[model samples]
Target: MHIYVYFIYLIKNIFILQYILEDKEINVFHKKEGNMEMNKPNILHIFVDQQRFDTIGALNNPIIKTPNINRLVKTGVAFTNAYAPSPVCVAARCSMIHGQYPANTGCFENDLMPLDNRQTLMDVLTKGGYRTHGIGKCHFTPDALALKGFQTREVQEELGVESVENYPYMEYLQEKGYKHLCEPNGVRGEMYYIPQPSQLPPEDHPSQWIGDRTVDFIKENGDNNEPWYLFSSFIHPHPPFAPPNPWHKLYRPSQMPLPNIPDEFESLHTFVNKCQNRYKYRDNGFDKNLIRTMKAYYYACISFVDYQIGRILDELEKTGNKNNTMIIFTADHGEHLGDYRCVGKRSMHDSCARIPLIIKQPGKFDGGVICEEAASLVDLAPTILGAAELKMETHNMDGVDLYSLIKGDITRKYVFGQLNYNGMDFIDADADFENYVTNKECKRAAFSTYMAANSDWKYFYSAPDNREFLFNKKYDPKETRNVVSNPFYKEELKNIKSSLINHLKECGETFGIEGSDWKAHKLPPFTKDPDRGLLIQDGYTPWVDTYIPGYTDL
Candidate 1:
């Protein structure tokens, strides 16, 4: 009996090794073949929301402990400079699905969404004889479960009450008798940064549910003879940095470092940046303690998520499909975490734009390799489709297949982005988009902003402000110095501006560019109302209201 068990274990390890060391080149599978799943590789895409680039312990972060993410970094190829195409929630998520920048997809902000006409990577995978399933927060518009391409999804949107019907996490809580104890995604608004423990236990938290559901999927499909694409999305470390019980106390505020809140950072802010600051409550009474505690809670939330990730990974190994799967991990965008005295996303600075991207495939670099190339979320779809060895002739993807990038077969000189201030990510953003963009008098609060970044420099142009910034990432990895006005770098600024213009023109999103220069206008920026409270207006009811569960005043 001992010999038989040992023999089976040895065979399983050998099987894992053999498949893991398959040919590096991605070969197409015959879609018409009945047993196509037998030859093709499975894909696992793990997504997190609003996680910054420096949170991984393996990635130079000494304060945060993320062993599972570290495991991925140690075993996969990690890219140090992956940026969101648009540094907001819906836009970046849409770009990942549609394989295009915001300009092309017409979903440049939270208010917009991927139109049903667009072909998604999941759609292509399903058509190519692979099962597609998404679990957790997708944040798609019109209908949360609007199956753009996924065969099905178990949604755990941020706010549980508003997206209540058919919401698995909420139903789980309700059935388990924990529904009255907690609100989704933690308490919100002015208390967004306060450190708090989750009302539910660690095993019952939404993050754990997402992980549990994913593991269950893998277990059920392990021997199904069909390759699959599973997108496991998590909503945490976004805001209200709440972690369950012990995890919430895992990190102390003293251990968490303060954000880069430079003395003059407020002066350096753009129109949209300033508005975001006021709305997020970073404008008043923000200090070192708050930032430190916020970081502590944020790290705790991440550690919790990382713990869940380990469960998913273990299941993959037990199912013996670990090596046959290509696991890609990334976030929609990043958080400010008090960087530049800002609290949330909606800026082109590295604090908000940069994301963590790690991809693990078999037969790759020895232990793992750290890639220094500049990558973007827009590249996600193309990479997935390429890995599945499937192609759709009807659509043109804005990003190149990442294998070309990893192999150094092609080099991307620049990754460009467009911006729309989604007005701080409120639920009814669509109803208020026009209101925020331009008032009745026609003065625009948010302008047409564009960004371009390569290996050395990062540039942004805000047409309404007639403001442009150029940061020498080579010298200022902190992105503190805006050298756009430095006469010594005039030519560098001109060249970057030209490249940005050409990109906009090429993509047909050049509303603020004319001839060879950016269009300049002296438009008034968004101003604060002295009497304005948390509510945008009196008697206004948002489709989804954010409040502290036990305490409502905040």
Candidate 2:
């Protein structure tokens, strides 16, 4: 019996060593194959909504305790500078599925469809012999075909009863005292005293259900020997900031630093800042303490989401496919969390544009390699399809294939981003929306959101007001100073503007205007006065300071 026990122990150790050796050989085998995986390593794309770049523990943030994500960082490639192509949920997720920029897909605004069926990444993957699946929020319009692609198991209808429309399972949860989900607004909604529904234990949360379904899929397919793509989409840390119980108290607010709310940052956002004063959470009926508690709860939501991810990872490992899987993690966009005194993702700043992207290509890539090269969420579909060796020829994708860099090809110079003032358009459709509709607006005026590489020389242009924001990321990653007007850097400004123009042109984005010499009307400048109706501040024209409370003013 003693000899048998020793023999079994030796066998277990041998198996563990073999696994480690196999992991090391992944990259070598990939290089040798050079774009060939026997059946294409199984793809697991984990997408979360409204997550910021600094929220995870392994990244620069030491405050947020995200153990699972930290583990992912230790064992995968963390793309430090990954950005959303558009800073809105529906738009960014559409880009992720199609590998195309908003301009190419025409789903440039919230509440819009993908515009064409031939464009989604699922269409490509399905044609490639891979089974695609999705779980969680489907915010896009006409979600029918999309659900069919993945055999989606999502919570339809709104999540709470106060909602004008019934979310799929919201009524069920609400009747059981999950009332907080019905509160239209969270801390920002100005409804704090509203009693929160009893926090759902992690096991009962919607995210957990999604994880279980994914586990089932993995187990069923683990031994089938067929490559699969499972997109487990979670909608936590997005709203009400109500991260259920236990999770709500999981982290202490004092330990978690307040977001970098730049002093007088509200002044920078002339449109949103003005409206904020008219609708404080207190005036809307939330208790002051409730608001504070909700803020803490939002952070808790982040931590809770992180915990769910840990659960999914455990399932992945337990199923024996962890070694051959290529797991891609990212978010649609980011939540402002009061940064710049903004509550949501309608701005073009880093807080709204920058997001986290970590990819774990087991056996094909190593852990601890941080890639600082700029990457766009739009590049996601192409990268995944390329890794799966699936042809993306039929789809008119605007993003570049980024699989090489994931396999250790990092000679990339710059990544690109675009903007749509979608929310701004809601406020002033006649101004910006008219341009996109008539195709007359040339630059930022006609678009919603915009971003460019965080190069030593960076330039931000708003086409409507002909406004320019120029900064040197090498000197100021925070983008506090707008040096577009500094005459000392005139040559550098001109060069960057030229490059910007060339980039747009290369992507087949024509403004119908010529040359990089175009400059904003500088003298006397555009301005708004109390006497002149609304101020054309922050390059947004026709922007009015207004608020329309939702939930019947509950």
Candidate 3:
């Protein structure tokens, strides 16, 4: 028996060695196929928070000057119709990290982090023999796990008090003798719609700090033989609308255009109207001047982020890793930026759902190719894994490989999105009638929302009121009109609804749909309570009553 067990162990070891050698050979083959200079490609994924698709200059926006991003677009494959699976921060990020939707991951809201044992993109890449590092705002709960599969991690927490010693950004500020400078404008936590110049110097700004740190990392590890995956996430262009120094004055408010509020905005869906009314009553509403000023600040923030990206790219080139690195630029979600009189996310509007996705695979694809393939952020993991010559089980991913879609090997008919208000707030089903309704006439309409969109049409379903909204993208790109009840487009509405139902079934989600027969999706078990650590360890504070437009109280 002992001799037989030894023989079996030897056989297993041989098979493991063969698998490793095969993986290396496959990587070499991918290099040759793509005409790459290295056997393994390094991935530099730069992600910005709350960035809009129209913000990039290459995407035809006349205002913002994103020359660096434009250069990537000029050389990369730009997906014109990319969207977020969930139009919120944590949920969308979870989808990207796990290659799964909110329902599958159980990360349905900003406060809900992924379960500890869940498989992440970093986990896969690290297991595939890549050195993974994460910089800036990872937003992972239990801060220690922020770098789960990352061999090294350096994070700059977004929101924190000076009293907290664990906040890296605050510590950096303290080191610079600029203690308590993050809130220099006297704006407490969750203060929104306040436009001002950053109190810190240009070099001391968080965006600049993130750029400097990332460049340092590249210079240190750029020439290493092992492949690496670095995620440089920036937290700017998300809130406070503050940019330091020259950036704050980069654009003049008077020269900017006003938000495109439709003439029939008041008669639009009740959910939208309610959001607008809430903002108006709560903050006394914003005027034209304030709106333009906010836009200027927002643009300045984007430009600053662009400058940092330029610096990072320059570092990559300096380190001789430019040709072997696959650069991906995208955002977690999009900001409303005064669209429909809204400033934050959490609605079904395109401004909040659509994100910019650009992938530059050296030598594999030509520059300046605009692929109009409908894609989602969830596809990012599989696409990156594919580029690295790694394979992921199809059953484990909700998004398809974007490279296949770009090469015309695979086609997607529609992309989907979801919003679970129940996950956002802790509300009693029987008490919160005003915000959540489950009546037969309007079951699943008030709090939960889902969306389905193809190349030409977009459909939204609100569960609280059983409301359905349909818009034709060819004519109504801004989604100003709801033609769901239009007799001429009855078939289109039905088709979209059917597509969404099929998707829900595939994802094993039964919520939002009005039926009790469907099976509930099996989500990963949370080993720890999501709200246990709060702001000290988690990047966010749950149930905080704040002045932000979209913030809710339990």
Best by TM-score: 1
Supply the global lDDT for candidate 1.
0.78
After TM-score superposition, the amount by which residue 276's alpha carbon in candidate 3 deviates from its true location, in angstroms, is 8.1
The global C-alpha lDDT for each of the candidates, from Candidate 1 onward, is 0.78, 0.61, 0.73
Model 3, residue 123: what's the lDDT?
82
Q: Order of candidates by TM-score, top first?
A: 1, 3, 2
Give the residue spans of candidate 2 off by over 4 A: 1-38, 151-201, 263-267, 270-295, 406-410, 422-444, 455-458, 487-492, 506-508, 511-554
Candidate 2 lDDT tens digits, 288-369: 3443454566667677767777877887788766766888888988866655545566455677778899888765444678
Write model 1 residue lDDT over 1-554, tens digit each, in one string.
Answer: 99999999999999976674465653323222354434577888999999998899999998788999999999988989888988888889988888888778877678668555768888899999898999998988867778888998898887544434677777667667653454546766656666678777888887889989999999988776678899999998788788888898898898778788666685558766765666666676668887898888899999999998899999989987777788998999988888887878878888888899999977542257898888999888888888777885567988877777988989977887877763333222343454545552122224556898876889998755678899999988998878898998998998888888888787776556667887654554354563233423111111334467888974
Where is model 1 poorest over a 10-residue stretch in terms of lDDT? 535-544
For each candidate in turn, the TM-score is 0.87, 0.76, 0.82
Cand. 3 TM to true fold: 0.82
| Winner of 1 and 3 under lDDT | 1
Please give, for residues 1-554, the per-residue lDDT of candidate 3 as tens digits. Answer: 99999999999999986785455223332232344344668899999998888899989998898999999999988998898888888889888988887767766557566655777888888888898998887877545336766777776756654343545666666666763343532232334566778877789888998899899989888667678899999888887678999889999999998887887764554353344223322124658788899889989999999999999999988987777788999998887766666667777778888899999866654468998778898899888888777865433888888878877888778988887654222222334543333452133223567888866988877654456789998899988888988999989988888888778767767654555322222222212333321211222322222454655532
